[model samples]
Target: MTTYPGMPAAPKKSVLPTIAIACLVIGVLVTGFFVYRIVVTVPGTPQPIEAGMVHLEKEGLTIYASVPVLTPACEAQDASGNDVPLKGPTGSETITINDDTWYVVARSTQPVPAGDYSISCTDDETSATYAAGPKSSVVAFVLSILGAVFSFLIFVGLGATLLTVGAVRKRRGNRPTNTFPGPPGAPSNYSQQPPTTPQQSNTFPAPPPYNPGPNPDRPQDR
Candidate 1:
């Protein structure tokens, strides 16, 4: 029987292949999740938002505001406290204020011009901050559940792989019953019995010196 010396062969692996596989799996999962969100959770279509119009009244430099104390309200006023005719269109539009755009309510009037003009809307100004509907909430819950499942699968896979490798090593008679050297109470530097065969020294062999010219005693005029 022949025996091989040196470390055991490690499982074959390639950096590019592993990375590509991981990226592909991640891309597929992410694309599926996003598609699900867009189709099911997100609102299918936006309905028209109604707006109640209030004619502006001139009073001093600022308009004395009077809005209903009930449903969503939007205040429209100008610098000179004059009523500015607005289309009051519903559904979504951008209004500029001081060169900065502010996305007001779809049901509200457009923003006022520069100067002392300012319009306030009940709708949130931040586009990212949306009033999530029930469908969106349910979608979030589903995503959370999926995330948990994926995490569990990864952890379980890793643990099972490690356990299987350990079992195989044990069957091959290489498992360590004790990884530490000697008894627990023994000092770390405690010497042990030397190997039966003496170890070969690692010192380098001596080299012969170089003679540049002929020996002085041998030369001398030939």
Candidate 2:
């Protein structure tokens, strides 16, 4: 659209809202990731893994050992004595309690209903340190959760601020405006000129008329 000079014009449409939405979506996904981590191990009480029946509060529990369980070397069973499915973890996550360390080994791929289960590992013999669930102190766990929440808020705030600014600019651009005329600009290549005066003639008539009259009177008398 045509616009007048000094007039506010609507800004060009942008993909900022799209970008903001993307940021929000990614933020939620990331936040969910933290939430999942917190949920998986946070609530479970740490119990020593052994050959006999152990009380497990949640399913998909991580199998921990001093060494990695490379295979389905470890397995579990439900309350009814049926063998439960277990899969080794894709990555390593560990926790240390009282200077003793236990690494994750395997977990249930699907949710197992909450109850007691018998945990058995074929190759693991280090019975003293074998354990499952989170071992981090209460303080560290709280900090990690706070960090996730802080990151989520930052992303959401950024998106919301961008959306608000864009909307305000668009509204202002669409609004009608008044522009007061300003003082005229100086002439281009102009300069001040000096004043001009009329010129006078330099020549004047001689006194010859008087001499010619005297000579005429003298000739008449002769």
Candidate 3:
């Protein structure tokens, strides 16, 4: 095989594409998991709240409950059948039962006013009413969606980076290397040089002196 003297070797194959593909798959899985958590209720034995009226002995009562995707509308009522709005504190807490996770929905700082009262929650989507207790909130659902979108975008960016690197490597691998040209009139494997010629001498040999015979007019002159 003919080889160029100063040619660089072809680039090695790149693993970036493989790594990018893995990242994409992982990102998809993570996004799907977060989306599922947002929509589905935590799995466990259901805890049913009492059907009758509940009395709040203290001003600040923390409510905990499990709910689906949408946040529920909740209220408290006094014995006089007057509706009271419940206040929710910021942040939430998680509860685990048999390895299943649940979220605290609301907490109130104001006093309930010692009296016969009832708490109820209505689903925002279905408008179904239930005894007020604990349920998932809008915050959890929004957070889950945000997390999923962020994770997916990050992974996609990584994959794009890897793909770009792989393409660059492939292009380099296929590129032609610089080559040195062979000498003129030389064999394929040999280097050629200019031919050398001998120099001529400047001096020449002297000719012998000229000799003449006796002329006819001077015959007999001996």
TM-score of each: 0.21, 0.43, 0.43
Q: How much is 118 displaced in model 1, in angstroms?
A: 27
Ranking by lDDT: 2, 3, 1
Give the alpha carbon lDDT tens digit for every residue of 1-222 in model 3. Answer: 465665655456678989999999998899999989766433223233355476544333345455422445666676789866565545555555687555555545454555456666555565322333323345566688888899899998898888998988788778664355566764554545689898999988998888877777886855
For candidate 2, write residues 1-222 as lDDT tens digits: 898875655667877788888878888887887777666435344577654656665545566776544553777777898877677666666666567666777777666776777777666444434555422334456666986798699887778877888788777777654454444684433454788787898989865554433454586755
Candidate 2 Cα outliers beyond 4 Å, as residue runs: 1-37, 40-45, 67-75, 87-93, 96-100, 122-128, 133-154, 160-222
In order, candidate lDDTs are 0.40, 0.66, 0.61
Candidates 2 and 3 compared: the better one by lDDT is 2
Quote model 2's TM-score. 0.43
Top candidate, metric lDDT: 2
Candidate 3, residue 139: lDDT: 55
lDDT of 2 at 119: 79
